[model samples]
Target chain A: MRAMVYRGPYKVRVEEKDIPAIEHPNDAIIRVTRAAICGSDLHLYHGMMPDTRVGTTFGHEFIGVVEKVGGSVHSLSPGDRVMVPFNVYCGSCYFCARGLYSNCHNVNPNATAVGGIYGYSHTTGGYDGGQAEYVRVPFADVGPSLIPDWLDDEDALLMTDALATGYFGAQLGDIVEGDTVVVFGAGPVGLFAAKSAWLMGAGRVIVIDQLEYRLEKARTFAHAETFNYNEYDDIVVEMKKTTDYLGADVVIDAVGAEADGNFLQHVTAAKLKLQGGSPIALNWAIDAVRKGGNVSVVGAYGPIFSAVKFGDAVNKGLTLRMNQCPVKRQWPRLLEHIRNGHLKPNDIVTHRIPLEHIAEGYHMFSAKLDNCIKPLIVPNAR
Target chain B: MPSTPYVSNKPKNTETREELRARIPGWGADLDPADRPSYPKERLDPSATGAHWDFPERQAGAEGREHSIEHEIVPPVFGTSVPLKGFSGAIRRHAYASYSEGRAAHWLLLILGDRVDAWESHLRSLASLRPDNPVTETGVLSERRRHGIASRFGVKRSDINHQWIDPLIVGAPWVAAGGAAVVVVRKLVRRR
Candidate 1:
């Protein structure tokens, strides 16, 4: 199997490797029909994560066909088309019962009492990831979402991770009607988070990022209010002015470690901080939100120890919610939205390259070239 | 649950005070090789209590009777326990490994039911292992509870042959009821 492998920080390569197989009874093997590079993948590729090995396959967001299943598996079978979430989870565990599948105990059996995840880490359970021709899925019943015939793989692919993460960020943000939602980093996840907030009835949706291209893309495609961080010397002040001199009701930190911001600064400044870098947007959100507001982080960060500010969070009575990705909870609803024509996340795919040119796609996406927003790797066809 | 004396059946061996100190180096110093203990075959008995601690019993073919030395403590598998508050009804509760020790211990209490007293005793015994100060005891208990401290006496003690220990506190009756008098106390500690 040919898969994209990470060579170094900001270096990725398309190389040949053995095809992944079903290792556990609840496992299933999926043939990658369509896969895309997510912001989280960039974290691993850029060496932001510690202990990320070179030559490990780099991909978590994908949709594929079931090629095989273990004897204990009953929810899915071969020939079924499914969208596999980046994080594998057992549907029957305590976390799963609460729809917190990303923290499933059986998925990353190698982790600290938490099971493994594909492409995550040794601390995260060291499962072989899905960026290849074939990917192994643990706890197949909960992780794989069956795609409706009306939905194409590209459209349903977001259900795997990106769209689900976005929706989860919005849901975690608790974007009630008439609330103003602001999302930092208008990357694919942030864009989806903004769109999900808009769908969930946020009166005004604002997105902030350093990339003017991404900010423009969110504004033009999703009708989101935009702020380019480079344009404003004081981002917090700018975001506050945009929200009637008040902060956002909810802020989604879509930019995890891959974000080129001072993580230590965020830990010291933001009271209720998320892992990874000090999300520059979180500082703005802390200044922007009402006395009692929420902040949802759906960014990719390693499991190694990180610091947070508790005093600021307590003072403002802010609620902080973060997770790997709530693919299990929101994937079904996202697929329904896609089937109903209410969501068109495929529009985020500004570049679609043949899988043969995966190496080039990685370079272009990393460089943010050719108006690239979300790039998809079509394995069989262009 | 009472703390069971960690006893083993093996042969007795002769040792000087220095040799005995080296065997259980609870204090972080190296044992002098010249002060090592020895056992002659005539005096060796494989079925005696406390004989396993004798270092020479390991050298004899009676090592099987000797308890394996390095015991790795497996942390507890914590389930969810919500504060019952004024209402005793069982609401849908969710547990995570990310929860605090007190929260996890509360869930253990709910599951242990009539055995709560026994479990509390076990926790107290574990607590007794702490220094004399109550403040230090509270801090240690809070840390262990968050991590899910398991008692071999409360449940089955892990064997020397076992690599992993099941820290799950089981046998609690998850029942339904109206209201009960309960109090929830929150404290601050180093966050993970």
Candidate 2:
């Protein structure tokens, strides 16, 4: 099998690796048809994540065909197409029982913070990712859902993480009717967050980013107001200015560790390794939302102390909600949204790179070179 | 002061929905209220938020906190917990100084620092008579008593795949530490 192997930061190569066999009865071998290089993958690619060992493949969002299944796997068989959620969780864990699949206690022996995630480094369970010709999907009964006959393969791939996570971010906001929602970051997740905010009865949606291209996507795709934070003297002040000086009712921080607005925060957190991640966007979220408002954070941050505004949050009585998206939990409503033409998850996809050229794909996305909003990987592409 | 043009019910651009649809593929798919699931809840009224201030008062105590090299000043408020310290702090400082976050060395060093910090905590705990327990902390006891082994054998468990490794990875460190302690005690006893 040909897989993308990590050779330190900013270096990945396609190398032949063994086709993984099912070591567990619930495991299934997937012949990956589509995979995506997520913005979070840039964390692994840039060596931001701890224990992202050399030779580990870096992909979590993928959909594929069931090439084989273990004896205990009854829900799927060979030749069935499935969309695998990023979480590798048991269906019956304490957390899983309550629909908190992302925090399943049984899957990851590495940490208790998050459940097993495919190819997200050893810190999230060192299971190899699907950025290859084939991948071993564990807990196949729980994680992989058969691709709906009406859904496109591209849409199914995006739903595995980006789309579902975006909706989850909005869901966390608890937006009421006519509430103003501001999203920080115009990445795929951010775009989806903005889009999902409107579906949750937000009166207005605003997306902020440094990039012009993504802001354009926010305007066109999400039909939300867009702001280039680089253009403003203080983006938070600008956020308040637009929301009647009360601040937005809800703010979502979709930009995680490598946020660009603050030079010092980015340098210390991202460059210096002082903090787990840059809290610039999250800090901005706390400041930009109205008092007693909601702040939904879906951005990927490492498990280290960030300089968050804990005092202000307490003083203002802000409801700060965050978690890794329980992708499967959001699927029912999201599937309905997609069926109703409310969301076209793949519309944000700008580039399709073959598995062989994934190194180039990572470089392009990481460098922000080609207006690449969402890049999909065709694993078996000729 | 006049409000920003963006804080209006009207679309920001002059282009109509049809025009946007023409230019961008699949645009305006959710434009109609009938098509939207939450249309009944969406009032599209942006003027109702009862806000009195032009700018909120800034929170105090943001001085002298760690910030990225890119900012001129810290945000109005920032967290003041868990300032970096100890030998692990030195390793982290070196990691920041030596390599860009884009390099694998930076993160590897950070992970190494975390391990060092864990050991430091363990040593501190030992002095406090509240030492870390490998058995309970690692959930090894749960496997014996809480149907952990029973759950993995016959049921469909992804973790069963890596069960072979769970012991060596978890137990080896403790075994090595125990052996080291035994050797030290033997030397002390021989001298006495």
How would you encode candidate 1's per-residue C-alpha lDDT over A1-382 as one tens digit per residue?
Answer: 8776554333454566777755556668889888888766655554444334444676677888899997667778899998877766555545555555666553332233334456753334445566678877766765676887888777787677787788677777765555677888788889888777755656667887766668888887666778766565677777666654546778888876544344344433221113444445555556666557898877765443344455667798998887676465565556556665567878887877776666566655654545568888776664
How accurate locally, in lDDT, is each candidate?
A: 0.55, 0.72
lDDT of 2 at B116: 65
What local lDDT score does residue A37 receive in model 1, on the 0 to 100 scale? Answer: 80
Candidate 1 residue-wise lDDT at A348: 84
Computed on C-alpha atoms, the DockQ of candidate 1 is 0.01
Q: What is candidate 1's lDDT per residue for B82-137, written digit by digit as tens?
A: 11211111210111222222243323322222133223333344456531222221
- lDDT string for model 2 (B135-177, tens) is 4333243233334445445432222343354355435656877
TM-score of predicted chain B, candidate 2 = 0.58
